[model samples]
Target: MRRKILKVLALAPFALLFTSCEKKISHEHREVHWDRDMCERCKMVVSERNHAAQVINKETGEAYMFDDIGCVILWFKEENITWKDTASIWITDVKTSKWIDARTAHYDTVHQTPMAYGFSANEKKESIVKDSEILNFEEMSKRVLQRGR
Candidate 1:
């Protein structure tokens, strides 16, 4: 009995460490395996940490990952998705590498993005650059659609 209690005490820290090390994914965004999870539209690996995009169905909570924002836009057109208007779109901030709401982020059109849309998103306009063209989500989407990639 004494030996068993000592063993349990010795292993308690390891058990706690394992449990605490588990990553906690939030409801807003799902876990992504960079370079492993294939993009839904372009079929490219989402290896670009700053250019990856995610679209989630508002009702069903299904997430579609893309290697670039351009792929996400083209995917909606190709699939004829009806839930796009109500979906939650997420993109990585080029400066911080943090996930941000794509619809509300400011975009700069001078990056070597994965799909070559030349657009990169950031939460703050000042972070993008000084004297560069900045665009809202709607404007960016329109420009990307016009490109028709």
Candidate 2:
């Protein structure tokens, strides 16, 4: 009986350690604290509510937040991370201040952004300002990369 009790006691620490070491997988968008949260790319404080963007790695459940859509585009290329279907890309809609899937969002290059990439996302292509062409995610990314080079 004493030997069994000692064996059980020895296993308790390992069990606790295993549970404590287990990672809590979270892939959801976390609320950004404006002025407090810094952009992952430019290191600027995310003060612009409508320009904020985020990339969440669905596999690792890690999130990288940015101050603008332009910053996110730059970071996405620089990181050399695969743009898999599982990756979640989110952008703030300028008109509604709501989060929208960047894959389907339309982008305009006339709007002033934090990194001066002049890109903004909108739910509708018609919402884009005049003189700016509505770009899909791939087109916007290419434009941003081209401008960076």
Candidate lDDT values, in order:
0.89, 0.84
TM-score per candidate, chains pooled: 0.81, 0.77
lDDT score for residue 81 of model 2: 76
By summed lDDT, the worst window of 10 consecutive residues in model 2 runs over 76-85
Off by over 4 Å in 1: 1-27
Instruction: Estimate, for each residue in 1-149, the C-alpha lDDT of model 1 and write its tens digit.
Output: 99999999999999999999986544387889997999999898999999889998877778999998988888998899998988889999997889999999999987889889988999998897877799999998888899896
Q: Write the per-residue lDDT of candidate 2 for residues 20-137, one digit (tens) a residue.
A: 9988877667788889999988889998888889889987888888988878877867877786457888999988879999889998877788878877889898888787778899
lDDT at position 3, candidate 2: 100
RMSD of each: 7.4, 4.3
Model 1 Cα RMSD, 1 decimal: 7.4
Cα misplacement distance, residue 21 of candidate 1 (Å) = 27
